[model samples]
Target: MSESGASPAKIKKLDPTEEVHETREYDPETQKALEEIDSCQNEIDQLNEKASEEILKVEQKYNKLRKPNFENRSKIIQRIPNFWVTAFVNHPQISAILEEEEEECLHYLTKLDVEEFDDIKSGYRIKFHFDENPYFENEVLTKEFHLGSTGDPASQSTDIKWKEGHNLVERFRQRMQQGEKGGTGRKRPLELRSFFSWFSDHGDPSADEIAEVIKDDMWPNPLQYFLVPDIEVENGEGDDDEEELEDEEVDDNVVVVEEEIEEVDEEGVEEEEEEEAPGEEDGEADE
Candidate 1:
């Protein structure tokens, strides 16, 4: 459906000079494949949005603290601003193929460095896999630096020029952590320490190799450990119980002291009345 609520125009028949749109109707197996492709594309969209937002936030924060400079900044601070996830548009060719034949298309958008992007004519690839067989394809798009500036239409590839320093793995890990924390609406607590051990062991062959050779190697866990509220709650509960007990003791003492004072006043009043009675009798006798 179009945004105006009108039915969208269907793609016209393929031209021989243009990219061919596959027109085969899908079998049940093909439908299943298409669904998987849709799912992956949706995940890719979500990752792109999250990575962009994270990068923007880091840049905004840094902009507030220090002027943008290429030097004298710590590596961690420098790295935070590079958290952008690559964005991808599904190959129109793939879409046309799906519409025609109903086959599932499998492809992933990966962030690329300048060198990597240059190698691919921009960082995009369309890979079609059916059963165990795979076919790889490419489409080229032109890029313009400024909006409204017309460039020779000679260069447009749907491929993205991957910006340098954009780390897909780290962005993916951060995204997964967010989902694990609360993004999925399940609100599960994530322990970064456990992830650190698994990630460090599996990926860093250099570190692992060094550690294996050393007899007394103790590697620091890289995952950030945050204090949970349960420990503080337990301590607070103990203090609250003690306070309640003290309040109860103070209330009991207040009541007992009030009763003792009332009894003493009553005894003093009785003695005063008895002395007054004797004085009245002496006055009557004198009269």
Candidate 2:
């Protein structure tokens, strides 16, 4: 669909080209060898297909095994304040698309779940559960990706019913429109797009980079992301590094002052000794 809420034009005009595919002529012996190579490739493909089936069976079994654990983990995660949002924002690729408002909006997100369809290879869906918030009316928003029987990939999402004046997606669109009209403080680039748009997006699901990142990277071990801030502190990777440097500078200044004080005290004692020696010499001369 186009940005204006309309489907794209169906007609695809092909450019004129001289390129053509042609099979190369080979000698009889070479052709026989080629046929043998093709047979070998077919066998390899058959083995690959069998391997895929076995892998899917294993995945299904494990998914069943992991269900109880995931539920228990979710129970604990709900106790933490803004757990999902924190983890989502800590994710490198996911964070890139999240603007300030989107980050705040995600605070309402209570839980997140991504489920593979029964076939596993056919499709998957990501579900977002939210607390009562000002952004929208939906408690749970879902986006599904599917591979059709014909092997065509498609995506669909729950329509976000926005609360009055709280649609960040619409806000972004308005900002883009305004920016086009030469009214702007700063315009977001294509890369820094709105998160809400991503949620509602149905285009080219197979190419959805954030979806893959969340499913493969963020979902499997969200605890790592939840502990991202602590991890960074442990690694000396943030503003704390500057603070440590400042403390060192303060310690050096204190050492310099102490040394100066010791030098002054030694000079004072030397002066007192010189005065006492002069007084003793005077007393001896009088006697």
lDDT of each: 0.36, 0.81
Report the poorest 10 consecutive residues by lDDT, candidate 1: 217-226
- Off-target runs (Cα >4 Å) in candidate 2 are 1-31, 149-151, 180-192, 238-287
TM-score of 2: 0.70
Return the number of clashes found in candidate 2. 0
For model 1, residues 13-90, the per-residue Cα lDDT tens digits are: 556788746545567776667656656666787799799778767755664454323122323322432211100112
The local distance difference test score of model 2 is: 0.81
> Which residue ranges in model 1 land beyond 4 Å of their true spot?
1-225, 229-237
State in Å the error of residue 191, model 1.
22
Displacement of the residue 197 alpha carbon in candidate 2, Å: 0.9
Best by lDDT: 2
